[model samples]
Target chain A: MYVAVKGGERAIDAAHAWLAEERRGDASVAELSVPQIREQLKLAVNRVMAEGSLYDPDLAALAIKQSRGDLIEAIFLIRAYRTTLPRFGGSVPIDTGAMTCDRRVSATFKDAPGGQMLGPTFDYTHRLLDFKLAAEGEVPAAAEVEAGTAQTPHIMSFLDREGLIQPETDSDTTPPDLTRTPLELPATRDLRLQALARGDEGFILGMAYSTQRGYARNHAFVAELRIGTVAVEMDIPELGFAIEIGEIDVTECETVNQFQGSKTQPPQFTRGYGLVFGMSERKAISMALVDRALRWKELGEDNLGAPAQDEEFVLYHADNIQATGFLEHIKLPHYVDFQSELELIRKLRREAEANNAAPSESAGASGGNLSGKMKEGAAE
Target chain B: MNEKTDPNAARKAWLSLLARCSAADLDALWTDAALDPDHTVLRTPEVGSVMVRGRAGAVGSAFNLGEMTVTRTSVRLASGEDGHGYVQGRDKVKATRAALIDALMQTAEADAIRAAVLTPLQAGMEQTRATRSAKATATKVDFFTMVRGED
Candidate 1:
């Protein structure tokens, strides 16, 4: 049994004061503002929003400042804060097809419609550090051309037209929300996507990499990866129509994977999709690969017994918040539990020593008795 | 009438414009517009969240993407128009201002409000979008094929 102990109030308050001082980090230095963090460290803010599952850049920035740039801690802060707010309602599913494209690229097609634009990418940049940035060197304004008015269609649509890829159908059924409902095994695709979208970037990246390295190998090609802003609309019951509530930046990746066909069906390419908040191309691409890997059963492909293919393993361990919470809880006061374990071990050792000292007077009887006591200690 | 001319469409456009514009910009426009329509707070300005959803493959069944922070309020102008404000982020003041502007738009002052507030907000949004889009367009690839000597 765990016993609650009190009387650290004074020490705890003092420690918190010390922590506050440490957080300030020398009064002489100019303090970091939340707006500065939001504008400058945008990628960090994005990650917090994605992982925290809350998209308020300002709040995310504040959390970052409060957590001293520890992203997971910032996410924890945002998540804890999220529980206090009332939920307004669900938005109409965002239309990515209508996204105002910032960066659009395709590996499959050489000249896809809405031509390949590598807007603000780090893809081909040399890894060498530019020391000039340390001096806060000013960057020249980017070259400009007239923005295209034509719609940039999804690359998958081309394959869909030719019947090259497996078709997907839309359903009106409301998807199961992981936030509101408990996650069950053998989760639907909707649930899986939701989990993968907010899953830890490093974990998802590793899992996606495993697939590329021939773990449940789905020969995937980046059909397209686009980063842009899409309008978020919601239908107000009183208004009788949907209105654009806000716009959010998102990165979408679609992977065309290798074909799987049975006797009755023609061989057609399968798809893996990923969409995430902000300019998170790496995470989006990784999520798509992992998503495709997990579609083994639905695609009628044999399960290769890969880690990525294990839904339970991926879903259970994907949430960093839950993982860190449980992992960090062990560091808390386990004094009572530890004391009980210590006592049991000591009792076992004492009994064994006594049995050894007794010289086996009743060798079999005493030995069995000692062994029984040891087993009892272990059980305790 | 087309979407642009429809009253509902006009409200949608203005509401969207209000939501999309920066909070600072909106505050400036709101103050300058001087649209203080006496209104009852049907719903006091409150902060909340809306679960955003996305489709798998951008074509399939929808899945919850995540939640975005939204602040909303409802107001009824003394002139007998009900207006609601739902905007992104946690600015209670902005939400109240939006609701006031929304209510004001329904009154005869819509033309003046549109000219003063909505027009400027639209221009600002367009400028931002055009600037970003132009930069992206500049990065569009211009691939060329090389001919062999034999050709």
Candidate 2:
């Protein structure tokens, strides 16, 4: 009779105790506060908010604190918490044109309606580390401008007016929520955008990088990139109007790609759009590039078999939570399967030795050979 | 009273008013008697998050910014009146009080609520806003130059 591994409960409890102690390393040091993480590790909080698809800065901060600065783990905490809350209703579509922009720029135009306001950016700064910044230093206030009602006109609108760019038609249909539904293949542009919005920033960046390296290369010019706060409003049936619910900061990017003229339509510059929660220009720009690449079919462009252009591949692998879960699950027990494989390999070797034959059967002997062939075929 | 009106507008106004009310004041405002009518919780007060979005640039496309915590509740009065409340933060009692007030405002006690709750809250918010604007204005710097004698 074999004694079962019944001490697992005690072991798990002890491990948890050890982990809690480890989390609060060096009792002499002050405990990290949620507000500190929210303010100090702002970029990390921003990433958790962006990828987690939840916007609460406080909760993101707390998640960071609890997760011990592991951003992906913090994002998982937020995402899990997000599923528990009941949705009130969908908000009225906000007007981006009415945004009070903090940082707005247009690479396509020498001069745009809102003259490039590069507020708090690292664009022109040298990469040299400022040692003094390690210590908390008060930042002097920048000049302020009176809030104005002048709406910023989109660059694409100008191109659209001149018939130089393809017009995007508005749809009143509600988009499918990925959170509530299982992902299906051949997703709509709306669904694709929704996925890309909450997709892993690093993964999206890599995919975008691949496109720039000549795989489905579309000469993309940053038509405009703006980061600012916009009012969120919801229609109240009782009030007979929509009222501003709140405000949040966002980063939006639009890329103008090379023109494609078809038999029925004249050559017009196509566009890619990206909108993410928070001040993340890199993610937003990358998302736009990937968005454009995925639209190759609809844009009447040749499918160059780029990885970014593969909708199924990109959507399925873009989520870091799912990716990490699948990758990490490998640490779990697979002893039974491994034992069977070991037995088979040993039996095969024994048979080969006894037969005294040539190594002809070696090619077909492995269990993974067929799958390897299939993987190659699929890649092609 | 001849042409009946939908109670939605009144409810929305009160809810919005309650949302803007100071959180500290809300604790003091909670009274068991003010929630006079028998009501059943349509939905228990629970905390959740809403994804705040913004349209940052020239394009009218909205983008996700992040989420904020909101506590919400709904209650139906015994007299067939329904009230809802949504407040920022995880304060359940505040959400409940707001919901109760919403239900009460829809009834004949609308005037009493307006006098007791709405007016004071609105005045307090206005005072806060005025004080903030005054502080901001005091720091405003105006730059001008006299005509240069050399020019």
Candidate 3:
């Protein structure tokens, strides 16, 4: 039985006081403001926003400051804060086709419609540390050119025209919200995508890497990856039509996987899609690969007993908040439970010793019997 | 003439503009315009979130992408016009001012408000977009193929 324990109030208060002082960290150093974190450390803010499933950079920055740069802890703070706000409503699906392209690239095409733009990427940069960044220095302004007037079309649409890729059917039916309801097994593609979008980036990336290593390998090619800002709109009952509520930056990845077909059907390329908040291209791409791997069952491909193919395993462990909570809870006081186990172990040892002393009297009650009893007690 | 054909279209345009305008810009514009009409808060500014949705493959069924912070409110002017504001982030004052501007846009003083507030805000928004677009445009790659000596 669990017993109520008290008397840590004063100690706990003192500990917190000391923690706050430590969090301030060398008062001589200039303090980091929330705005500075939001603006300068934007990639960190994006990760928190994507994982925390909330898109307020200021709050994410504040959480980062409070957590002293522990991203998971910052995500936890954002998640907790999210529950307090009243949800106004769901926005109408954002039109990514109309997105103002910042960085758009395709691996399948040499020159896709609205030509490849490598906006603010670090792909080609040498890994050598830029010591100049340590000191304040003025950087040159980014060069500018006249904006292109041509439309930037989705590369997959080109394949769709030739019936080369599997066509995704449009649906107006409302999707089941994972947040509103507990996640059940055999989750639909929409639900799986929702979970994976906010899933832990590192976990998803690992799962994706596993797939690339021939674990349920679906020869995936990044059809396109684009990052840009899109307007968010919602239909207002009072206004009688939809209006642009706001705009948010997002990264979208589309992967074209190897074809799947039977005797009755012609071969067509399968697809996996990922859309996430902010410029989280890595997370977005990983999500697409993992998403494709999870679709083996639906796509009529054999399940290779891969971890990524197991939807339950991926979705269950992908949430770092839940994982960290359960894992860290063990460090908390379990005095009663541990004491019971200790007493059980001592009792078993005493019984074994008694059996050893009286072996002639109880020849049938051997060390094996004592071990079996100990196992049962441990189970209890 | 466009407004006459679709009466709500103009309001929609101005509301969209107001929602995208920076809070600082709106505050400055509000003060410079020197416009303060008697108004009642039909609903006080409340900070909340709206679940943003996106389509699968940019064409298929919609799924929840995430939630974004938004502040919204409804206000009615003494002249009986009601206006609603929904702007990004948790700026309560911006929401209130936006609602006031929205209401003012429907009144006889709309042209004056448009000149003093909405026009400048639209220009600022356009300038920001143009600058980003220009920078992105500069990054466009012009791939060239090299021919072998034998070929």
Candidate 2: residue A364 lDDT (0-100):
43
Model 1 Cα lDDT, one tens digit per residue, A34-82: 9999999999999999999989999999999998889999999988988
State in Å the error of residue A286, model 1: 1.0
**lDDT head-to-head 2 vs 3, winner:** 3
Off by over 4 Å in 3: A1-3, A358-380, B1-6, B149-151
Complex DockQ per candidate = 0.85, 0.17, 0.83
Q: After superposition, how far is residue B4 of candidate 1 from its true place, in Å?
A: 7.2
lDDT per residue as tens, model 3, A234-350: 877888987888889999999999998889889999999989888999999999999999999889899899999999999999999999999998876666676667668767877
- In candidate 2, what are the lDDT values of residues A255-358, reduced to their tens digit? 99999897888888988888887789999999999999999998878988999999999999999999999899776555445455656876787787769865
Mark the regions of model 1 whose C-alpha exceeds 4 Å error after superposition.
A354-380, B1-7, B148-151
TM-score of chain B of 1: 0.92
TM-score of every candidate: 0.93, 0.77, 0.94
Q: Best candidate, DockQ-wise?
A: 1
Give the DockQ of candidate 1. 0.85
Cα displacement (angstroms), candidate 3, residue A279, comes to 1.0
Q: How big is the positional error of residue B41 in model 2, measured in Å on the Cα after superposition?
A: 6.3
